[model samples]
Target chain A: MTSLMTPKYATVKSAFWGGVREAASVPMLIMGASFLGFGSMIKDINWSISLAIFTTLSTWALPGQIAMAEMAASGAPLLAIVLAVGFINARLLPMSATLLPHVRHPRFPGWAYYGVAMLIAATSWVGTLRRLPDLRQDQKMPFLLGYGLLLYCGSPLFTMAGYWLSGSVPLPVTLALVFINPLYFMLLFLQDLKDPGRILAVLFGAVLGPITFLYSPDWTLVITGLVAGTLAWYLDGVLKARRGTDES
Target chain B: MNPELYNPVWVITLAAAVSYASRGLGVALSGKLNPEGSVVEWITCVTYALMAGMVVRMLALPIGALVHTPDWVRFIAVLVGLLVFFIIRKNVGAGVLAGSLFLMFLMW
Candidate 1:
């Protein structure tokens, strides 16, 4: 593995520009379409348009935002809303941690680290991870910041557009827009199937998630994630140990 | 029910803080944490599991307009998506387009 500190093909400026350039295409479309759907959904629920845009600006994670909107609309308590959104977004914790070491540089102040970390979302995290192996340490932070900034800034506009265009757009088209982000994430998971642990985790989680949902809608995500994930991880560990023993 | 309970400003602020707290905590811990440790491994598993759970929920038990379409149609669309994805060497855009168009057609 190349050292994380080495500068290969990117200075901060070039990497930032590179990130901006990369964000101009598919990621932009994905964010736009998803936020549009979110905006429309909020509108459908009769929530404040400003709130919808605020959710886009703050949470930035589609599922959590959607959960908050839905729950709030249903008159779920504020504490419940917070807990639900927090649990839905719990995945970001690990994602941020995983991506941080690659992007953190000593030259950047501690405050810069946290600010950049705030910008880390699924799009930026995945894009950065995929590209990080090829980038210099100096490039990682700027590239991610630039990429995240574009998506962050553009999302609210799309959200507002979708809010206004909610009823105007055909129902099927709006639904398709909503489906895009989930489908993209699913396919991305499928694309990277080499890791047995992750594959098992996905399979187990898929099987258990809805089943658990049938029991408790509010705690479904947290319960399914913990139970299925731990089970899969344990099973994978056992299998690996047995294989190692056999090989030895 | 108090109308203030549903106030957008308060709800959005609280929700945003809660969400940001998770992301921020991860960043705070990252510097001191070893990514390869067992704890990190468990966290990674949980994240993967959470993502998978959310995807499954979206596909099998969607809310809003998606609930209007037949479940089988959505399932078949996903299947066709996987098929196209493999056939085209895992081109996500093409695969997603195929799935989305298929669903739209079925809905129409």
Candidate 2:
């Protein structure tokens, strides 16, 4: 997407600044707070603030960072820690593909994509999905640039703050503090759609992951995603066709 | 390792690299992903659903400190949080605080 960002309207300078401006929304705040909680969790586990911020800057993928932080805290072996965190972030592959389609220009160098790839995460991706359709094809990159930068700068600060707080807080408060991250996600999705099939897919995925985890923890999300996503697709297709026929 | 002092650069690096690989893999797999047509929408939906679903489960059936509190109380807090968002006209921060405060209030 960075390649497509033209020198004409969406210059690198403007796009960088655009990313800064867009990050000021409520959703961004939710994401920032949640990451702050995560940062505290990392500090609670005794990870270095500098290293955690480094991960924030370079890794940018929060779930993966948290998984690594938790596993390392548990004294898992280095290789196992890497593998598990990687597995948790397997979803990013599709996310990049989706967002890349909108942002990538034919003339854009591959390396730009690589750099942009560093900033990808759930919060920015969600914002991009909502914002991309409204942007000119040429403008998408700047929008993403702005959005990504917003998150990029905010996350590390939150992590630093979280690291500072995790120790002084009590256990029950700490436990509740943890809930802030995931709960923020739920609220973000609350008004997202009137699409029944999509909503059903979300509901199914939500229920199936944990339930399946009771049997097979590692595979639950993959299994549930395949099952629920497939189900939602067909259900939407059938509904669409039925509506078409009735219109005829 | 004690829960209070370890350098975790290796862990952070592994995670970032892993995340980058996933993002790159998507670019490589784009041709096969098939975002259009019947199956793809469902796939995206399912994938999103799985993500959302896992989150809901985590909150609904939290394994840690949330376990110490009664399930009804936690669920009610979520409900109250959602209610306040509507009651106050869709404020995200308000809803989150309502949810957080409800939990804390129940514990109190």
lDDT of 1 by residue, B1-108 (tens): 343556778888887887788788888887676666666667657767766886888789876567777899889889878889989999887888888778877777
Residue range A1-248, candidate 2, lDDT tens digits: 74465333356566556656667777578777777778766666555788878988877877666556644654655665566556557667777777787787766787787677766777788877766765666677777888887788888898887777666776556655666666666776676657777787877777786787677554555567677766776787788899999999
Superposition error at B91 for model 2 (Å): 4.0
TM-score of chain B of each: 0.76, 0.63
lDDT of each: 0.77, 0.69
Going through the candidates in order, their DockQ values are 0.55, 0.48
Model 2: which docking level applies?
acceptable
lDDT of 1 by residue, A1-248 (tens): 44664334536797887888788898888667778778877877777788888888877887778767755655666776676677667767777888888887788987787787778787778866887767877788888888889888898999999888866778887667666656767888888877678889889989887887777665666777788889888888888889999999
What's the TM-score of each model vs. the native? 0.84, 0.74
Best by DockQ: 1
User: Who wins the lDDT comparison?
Assistant: 1
Model 2 over residues B1-108: C-alpha lDDT tens digits? Answer: 343344466567767777789888777665477655454455457656765755676677654345677878778878888898779877767887778777777777
lDDT of 1 at A198: 80
Candidate 2, residue B5: lDDT: 48
Q: Give the range of the ten consecutive residues with the poorest summed lDDT in model 1 chain A.
A: A1-10
**How many clashing residue pairs are found in candidate 1?**
0
